[model samples]
Target: MAALLLIATAALLAFRGAYADKVYPAVAVGDVPVGGLPRDAAETRLAERAAALAAQPLRFAAGDRTWTPTLADLGVSLDLEASLGAAYRVGREATAPDRLWSAANLVRNDRAVPFGLRLDLGVLGRWCDGIDAEFGREPRAAALVVEGATVSIEPEVDGIAVDREAVRAAAVAAVAAPSDGVAPLPIVTTPAAIRAADLAGARARVGAALAAPVAVVHEGRRWELAPEDLGRFVAPIVDPARTGADAVTLDLDQPALAAFLSERFAAEIEREPVDALLGWNEGPVVVEEGVDGRAIQAETFAREVTTAFFAPGGTVPVPVEIVKPAVDGTNLDQLGITTLLARGDSNYDGGSFDRDTNVEVGARLLNGTLVPPGGEFSFNGAIGEITADKGYVVSTVVQGERAGRDIGGGICQVSTTVFRAALLAGLPITEWWPHSYRILTYEHDGWGPGYDASILQPEGDPFGGGDLRFANPSDSWLLVESWTTGVHVVVNIYGPDLGYDAQFSETTFDGPFPHEEADLETVNPALPPGTIEQTEWPLDGSEASFTRDVYGPDGELLESRQFFTKFRGRGNVWQVSPDMVGQSPAGG
Candidate 1:
């Protein structure tokens, strides 16, 4: 026994010395045997094995779906030095007797050393996120639905999500044992935040709000909203104050409600304010009182209706806004119209019935017109369009150098009167056009030839018409009062009396030229053949001009302006038959 013990001791010392810088015999790293190999050689062998494993595809299975990805693609690699060191330390790290026993046992049965793996958790997590996005289902919260007068709740749904950590751990295990490269995916279920029980209160509130029809009253008018219509204005919203199942509330869509109210009641509740009409009796007098306008307060009324919708009664008073007129009866004194500044009169006696009717209609339209301070007064704008619909009659009118019959023929009588009033008032005449020829009606009542004003509305163009316009240079509103007596039409201007005296110089005449011979005759299809009827007598042409000097109340001249009038002469207008058309008179 003594001799056998000495031989065993020698063998043990040899074994320890042989493996001092190498792995023990029968030790392996992931099936790659590194036993009795030096540290560098063992590391090289392990690295070669790891490279082969990394190149191989790893299978990941979730249900029937599977993904085959290489270990290197998953950012996984073997720590070669750490694995080799572990393999080398196995038999040498224990007590002497145990170390000897382990070394002897390792020779008979190979021992596997767990691979020290380097895993990129970031990569693994991102890969798992992609899988989750592809196959995961998100939970749906409960909500309220309104259809007509009926209300109900939609149930919540539960969802499934992949367990990313479990997936990562499984991948690591599969990479370590390349022979079994398949990993099973783990899944978890998620519960929704709000369930059907949470929206019960909201559903009930919405149902009650739409249970009955509501009425909105303003003055004597009443508008009704049916239960079905009310449903469109109410909706369910998430309540931030609560959590879990009790976090939902029903609220009214105020804007939608306001729009609904406007559509139903706008025409009846809204109106424009009427300004007070002023007339001169002895001084400035309010002939008619002004009326305040009415408008619907849509938003305010909507809120009130929302509150009333849940109240005991279904009747709610509509909120209204009263709009005051700019010129009211009590504010006449503020208008600064203290006296009559000027009065212009024209004689329309012995005229035809159509001419008399047109002059009366024109004067009535001009009555009670107001010109704001420093604002231009447009005669065409004031009287609007001279149409037959506005009570104008067909009468004689001047077109270019010829007198013809058309609608609104005698309307110039009114424009001429307004021009005389504005001129006498010392107002600035911005636009003025004289008649194409002299008219005895304008030269009536001692007014000379240069005092006429003409206005015409061009066909097919509203703004292209001729207009007599003037500017009020005062600090007060000017009112025009026009009326007609039995034979004479009168127009008067009322405003703050700016003390001004207007002086007119003697009128000068230039020529009495005759009309072109071509214009002497015109073809008339309505007249009989070989017949000639003189429609108008010939009138000689003349140029008339006069200067006016406006003086202030203190005798200081304020303005000096010259007014010029060119009257084109016309030969006799004769309506001849087609056979006699273009024929000159016998004398010529």
Candidate 2:
């Protein structure tokens, strides 16, 4: 057993010696360990190789061109000093000794070397076509046939340094896995149609039918745009073909749309008023006459009113026409009459139409007819008479005291004044009457012609009351004016000039020829016999004639008109004392 043991030990020793010979030698002190040598020796060999490689040019072959780049040309090393700078530095300091084991691990760990990437869009140095190139191999054209992509690994010295390669492989597998590509979906707005839209029709149908509707909306303030009436607001809608997406965009002109909607869709409307004035019968005329010498103008009253149109926004007012009043002359017989007669019986009982009262009435008529075509004239309508009620003092009637007591007593004076005015106008007579018994107030003397008077009584015989009526008988109108100046009554007739030649000659017969007893008496008296108050005399008949000739524009006689009058005889009037005989007071 001992012998067998000795031989086996020897065999083991022999195998151990062989193994020790095969193992790498211990690195020198301060020298780094390399895979094949000590760190110091590995650095020396690497430096020699680098120096040789840098001196020569690097060769590169692409499709048809081969390029050699010297270290100087490639700008890799600008100088020998920069290339030789401590090429084997490991850690911080160049003088620090390299740890063999760590250096060996460090060299093995580093995988990437610095390289430049350049893209040549155009051929370098010469022009060429149909080619695009880069500093690295072409990505799309090169058939790599790679079992797997070559990848660099970053080793962790903190852990097992060699195991870091396996970790890098796993990370690369995660990034290289395939992923899906997605394109964004397009969105588009739809287009409007080219046909006319029913905008107005739709708006009208929205409200009540019987109501008055504002149909169209016109221009607006901000922008001058006409609103679409019924058929223009909406347009046809279309979809976008690319994305199968569709939408309608309202292309409303902002202001126009606002106006349209406000008018059409409105719930209520408004209204207003208007007024105007108008004229009648030509116009106001010039009235030269004034009341009591005060100048008065022609004036008339009128009326006016308003009209309106109500619109949606507000009221629009306008003007209308007016109506007026008119004054017309009717019952004109009084205007033309020239004479009147009133008589009292022997009783002195006031039986006749008082001459003064008749005269005043005639005055009123005269003034009215004198109003010119475009002039104004009035009587009470003109100058009003003052009598008992209107405050005129009473007086005995002129020409005849035999007439009974009357208020407007001596107003026959007014009648005479008007009669003269009428004559001056050359008016025509419609009626005329003479005073009874040839009163001296008119005839002045028994031989003088008597003044004509107008009687407005209904009707009477030739010997009774009669009326003289006359017309202006001219193209121009007349304005009659009369007023009492002190005791004289002045009358004026205003009219266009009438070219006339008028003349009158009167022939009177004798009067006071009747012989009668005294039949009338004083109120209180005791006079002796033969108290002759007056004498009654019958008058001789006589005739008087007037000739009126009108001339033309040349002053030649155009017409000769004649007027004739016959005087009748006066009857005998008696006077007597009241206490004497059968006659007490004649009127009583």
On TM-score, the leading prediction is: 1
Best by lDDT: 1
Q: What lDDT score is found at residue 417 in candidate 1? A: 90
- Please give the lDDT score for candidate 1: 0.81
For all candidates in order, the CA lDDT equals 0.81, 0.34
User: For residues 234-345, what per-residue lDDT tens digits would candidate 2 score against the true structure?
Assistant: 2213333321112222122334434454443233221221111111122222232212111111011000000100122222111112222122232222222222111111
Candidate 1 segments whose C-alpha is farther than 4 A from its true place: 1-216, 223-267, 298-318, 384-391, 398-407, 457-464, 513-517, 520-542, 553-557, 566-588
lDDT by residue for model 1 over 1-588, one digit each (tens)?
998999988987888898889888889887788888988998889889888877877676777888776777676778887888789888886688788788778868989888888888787677767777888789887777778988888899877777866766665777655545556657777877778888887777778877888887867777778878877777556665666756665567898999988778888778888777789877678888889998889999888888877662668888889999878887888888888989988887667888889989999988988888888999888888878899987888742337478888788888899999988888788999998787777777888878878888887664477899988888898999998998788899999989989888988878888765344666767777888777778788889998888999899999999999988777777777888765647222
> Candidate 2 has what TM-score?
0.31
For model 2, the superposed segments whose C-alpha errors exceed 4 Å read: 1-369, 372-387, 391-397, 443-448, 456-468, 506-545, 552-581, 584-588
If scored against the real structure, what TM-score would every candidate get?
A: 0.53, 0.31
